[model samples]
Target chain A: MARKIDPDQREQHKAAIAEAVWRLVARSGLEAVSLREVAGEAGVSVGRVQHYFGTKDALLLYGLRLAQQRMEGRIRRRIAGLVAPGAEDVLRATLAELLGDDPDTRQAVRVWTAFLGRALDDRAIAEALFADDVELRAFTTEVVGSPLDAHGLWALANGLAAEVACGQTTAADARAVVDHHLDRLLGSPDR
Target chain B: MARKIDPDQREQHKAAIAEAVWRLVARSGLEAVSLREVAGEAGVSVGRVQHYFGTKDALLLYGLRLAQQRMEGRIRRRIAGLVAPGAEDVLRATLAELLGDDPDTRQAVRVWTAFLGRALDDRAIAEALFADDVELRAFTTEVVGSPLDAHGLWALANGLAAEVACGQTTAADARAVVDHHLDRLLGSPDR
Candidate 1:
C-alpha cells in the first residue's frame, strides 16, 4: 500500500535536505556532496532524495537557484533601506553588504564559490549567471559613473570577490575600492 | 616481492602524476579525482599513487601548490618584458594576462577555480593560497595606488574571473576593465 505523505511535511523535508546539502558543501565543498550523503545527512531515505530532487545534479541545480534567490532577496531588502545615499554610496553599501562576512552572507559565498567551478560545464547555470552578471555590471557602471567600455565593472567586481573569498582583503577594503572608482567616475573633489 | 624501481624513473612518474592531476582537475574538477582514477589517467598503478602522494589529501595539497606556482611563473614571465608602465599599467597588464582566455591561461584558471573550493576545507591548501593571495593583492595595490585597496582589487579580479568563466563577458571586455581601472588608478580623466 502506498503511504500518503503530507504536503507540508514534504516541503519541510525538502528544506531540510537543502540545509543538509548546504552544511555538507560548507564543510566539505560541493564535490563532496552525493545523493546518499545528502539523504543520510538529512536523515531521510535515498528514495526521498530521489522523489524530491530526481538526481544529484537536480539537487545541486535547485540548491544553486535557492542560493541565488536568497542572495537577490537580501540585496533587495538592503537596497530598500538605503534611504538617501548617493548612487555611488548606495552601490558601495549594497556591495559591502553582499560581500560582508555575516552568517547568511558567508554561507552564500561558500555556496557560490563551490558552484563556480561546476558552472564551467553546466550550461544552464552559466547562462543565468552570465546574464545576471551583465546586468549587475551595467548597474555598477551607471551608479559609479565609470565610462568603462565593457567588462570593466565586471572585472573590478570579480577581483573584489576573489580577494574576499581568499581572505586576502576585507569588506571595508572592497568598499574603499568602489568609492575610489566612484570618485574617478564623478571627477570631483567632493566625490 | 615488489619490483625494484629506479629513483629517477620514480621522480619522472611523480611529475607525470602531478601533471595529470591538473589536467583531470581542469577537465572535470577536484571531486572527480581519486588515487586510482589519477593513476589510470597517468597510466600508472594505484600503488604508485600511494607511493608518491602518501595520501589523497597530500596529493591534492601538492597539486594545488604546483598550480599556484605555475600561475605565478606565467604572470612573472608576462611582466618581465614590460617596461615604463606605471603602477596602474603594470596592474592592467598583469591582470589581463592572468585572466586571459588563451588555452594555457584558461587551463590555469580552471585548475585554480576548481582547487579553491577544495582549499576551503583543506587547511594546507588554504594556508598556501592565503599567503599567495596576500602577495598578489599587495602587488596589485602597489600598482593601483591607495584608493584601490587590496580587497577591492581582489574582488575586481575575482568578479572578472567569474564573469569570464561563465562567459558573461569576453576576454576583450576583461582587458577593457583592466585598462579602465588602470586609468582611474593613474588619475586620468574619467571615461
Candidate 2:
C-alpha cells in the first residue's frame, strides 16, 4: 500500500516552493521564474515542484495566492495583539500591513507587481489577482460598515502602501497621507 | 562625416523604438525586453537601436520616459481643448486620462507595472518611475492649489486607475469611487 501524504507536510512543501517562486520573481521578475530555477532556488528537485504545483501557470498562481494568505495572516496577527482595537485602529493596522514595511512582504510586493504587469493581458491571471484585491476591499467594506466609502478607502490605503513598496514614496509620507484621508473620513476620534 | 540628424526625425525614431519596447513589454514582461527583440519588434536593425539607446538599461529607461511624455502630451491636449476648464474640471480630466481607457494606455500601464516590480529592488528604475509619479503629483498640487491635498488626491485617482488597468476593479466602480471621493472633496459644484 502507498504511504499516505500528511496534509500538514504537504502544505509546508507547497508554501516552501511558493516562497522560492516569490524569491525568484522578486530577484528578477515573473518571466524569470521557471520551475527548474525555482526548484534550484528552493534546493529541491524539479520533479518535487511539479509534483506539488503541476504546471508553471498553476505554480505562479499558487505563489500569488500564498502571498495573499501570508499578508492576511500578517494583518490578523498585528490586529490580534491589540487590547481594544477600534475599527479605525484595525483599518490602520491593515493599511500598515499593506505598506509592506518588512522584507518578506516587500519581496512579495515585487513579485505581485511583476504578476500584475502580465495580468492585464492574461485573463486568468487578472482574475486571480483581482480576487485577492477584492478580498481586501471586502474586508475594508466590512470594517467601514459602508460599501460606498470602503472602495475609495481601500484604493487610497493600498495605493499609498504600493507607492511605498515600489519606493515611489516614503513610509512616513504614506502614513501622513493615510492619516490625512482617514481624518477626513472618520472625523473626531471615537474613543 | 555622418548624415545630419533632423531633431524631429531623431525624436520620431527614438519614440518609435521606445514604442516597440512598450509593445514587447506589454505583450510579455520587462524581462522579455532585449535590445535585439525590440529592434525586431520595430523592424529596425540592432545597430540602429544600439546607436539610439547605447544599452538595454538605457533603452528601457528611455522607453518609460517616452511613455510618460506621450501621456503628458495627451493630458495637455485634452486640457487645452477644454474651454475655460475649472480646477475641478482640469483635475477630472487629468484623472480620467490616467484611467487607461484606451488600449494604448492599458498596454503602457502593463509595462509600467513590470518596471515598478523591478523598481522595488532596482534603485535607478525606482527613481525613474518615482520621478514620473512626482510630476503627476506636482501637477495635481498645482490644480488643487494645496500641496497638502495633492498627495492624497493623486494617490487615490491613480490608484483607482491602476485598479482598472489590472482588472481588479471595474471602470464603473473606479469612476464611482473617484466621484464619491471627489464629491466629498470638491463640495458644491462651481460653474
Candidate 3:
C-alpha cells in the first residue's frame, strides 16, 4: 500500500527545515546554509527538503518570511491582551518586542542581518525589505505624530536591536532606552 | 642582490590588501574573504599578505581599525574646516561624515556589519568592537549633555547608517533625520 501523505505533517516538515536554516545561520552565518547541510540538520532526506523549497534562494526567502510572520504573530498576541491599549502602548509593546533580547528576537536578528547583507545584492529582497520599512514607518508615524520622529524611532529601535544582539547593551538597558525615547516622543506619564 | 623594501611601500601594500578585503566583503559578503582570495584581489603573493596579518581574524581586525581611523580623520578634517565650531557643529560634522552615503561609508558599513556577525562568536573582536562603542558614547556625551541620550544618539546614527547602506533610506534623508535629532538634542541653530 502507498504511504499516506498528510498535509499537516508536510507543513511541519517545512517548518522544521526553516528552523534548521535559522539554526545554521545563527551558528555559522548565512554562508553556511546549503540544501545538503540543511537536510542533515533537519534530519531529513535532501530530496524531501528539496520538494518544499526548490533553491537556496527560495529556502532563504521562505525562512525570512516565516520568521517575520512569527514575529508579527507574537506582537499581535501581546497587543491583544492589553485592555483598551493606546497607540503609545501598542507602539511601545511592538518596539519592545522587536528589541527584546529573547531567543526568538536573537534568532530573528541573526536571520535579519544576514538577509540585509543579501538584500544589498538582490533586487527582489531589497524591494521586500524596503516595503517592510515603509509599512513600519507608517505605523510608527501613527503613534508619534511626526514622520521624522517616527523614522528616528524606527532607526533607534533597530540600532538597539543590533546592539543588544551583539551584547554591547543588555536587554534591560535596551528596554529602558526604548521607554525613555517613547516617553520623550509621546509625553506619557512616567511608569 | 636583496630587493629593498621601503617602509612607506610596505605600508601601501598592507593598505592595498585591506582595501581588497573590503572590496571582497562588499561584493560577496564576509564569507568571501580568504587569504588566497585577498591576495588574488590585491595582486600580491599569498605569503606577502600572510606576512602582514598572520590570520583571517588579524586581517579583519586590521581592516576594521584602519577604516575607523580613516573615518575619524575625515571627521576631524571636516570639523577643523568649520569656523568657531561648537560641540554641536563637531557632533553634526562627525555624524554627517559617518552617515555619508559615499562609497567609503558604504564599504565601511559592509565591512562593519560583516565584522558584527563575527563578533558574536569571537570574544576578542567583540571586546574590540564594544570598546569602540564605549569610546563613541563618551564623545557623544560631551556633545549631547546626557550620557543616556548620547547612547541613544549613537544607536540612532548606527541604525541610520545600516539603513542607508542597505538602501532603505537615502543618505540625504538620513542626514535630514540626523539633523532633526541633533537639533532636538543640542538645540543648535538651524543651518
DockQ of each candidate's interface versus the true one? Answer: 0.49, 0.50, 0.51
Kindly provide the TM-score obtained by chain B of candidate 2 when compared with the true chain B.
0.86
Which candidate has the top score in TM-score? 3
Candidates sorted by lDDT, descending order? 3, 2, 1
What's the distance in Å from true for residue B69, model 3?
Answer: 1.6
The DockQ for candidate 2, computed on C-alphas, is: 0.50
Model 3 per-residue lDDT tens digits across residues B33-87: 8899999999999999889988888998888778777777777888899999877
Candidate closer to the true structure by DockQ (higher is better), 1 or 3: 3
Kindly list the per-residue Cα lDDT of model 2 for residues A120-154, writing each as its tens digit: 66778777666765666676787666676788887
Count of backbone collisions within predicted model 2: 0
What clash pairs does model 2 have?
A: none
> Ranking under TM-score, best-scoring first?
3, 2, 1
Per-residue lDDT for B70-183 in model 1, tens only?
777787787777776555556666677767866767776777777666665666776866666666667766665553655455566666766665666677776677556655
**Model 3 segments beyond 4 Å from truth?**
A1-5, A128-130, A189-191, B1-5
Cα displacement (Å) at residue A180, model 3:
0.9
Consecutive 10-residue window with the lowest summed lDDT within model 1 chain A = A145-154
**Candidate 1 segments exceeding 4 Å error:** A1-12, A84-90, A128-131, A146-150, A165-168, A176-180, A183-191, B1-11, B83-92, B147-150, B187-191
Worst 10 residues of 2 chain A by lDDT: A182-191
Q: Native contacts retained by model 2, as a fraction?
A: 0.52
lDDT for B21 in candidate 2 is 92
lDDT of 2 by residue, B81-148 (tens): 99998767888887766673667766766677667666766677778777766666787777666665
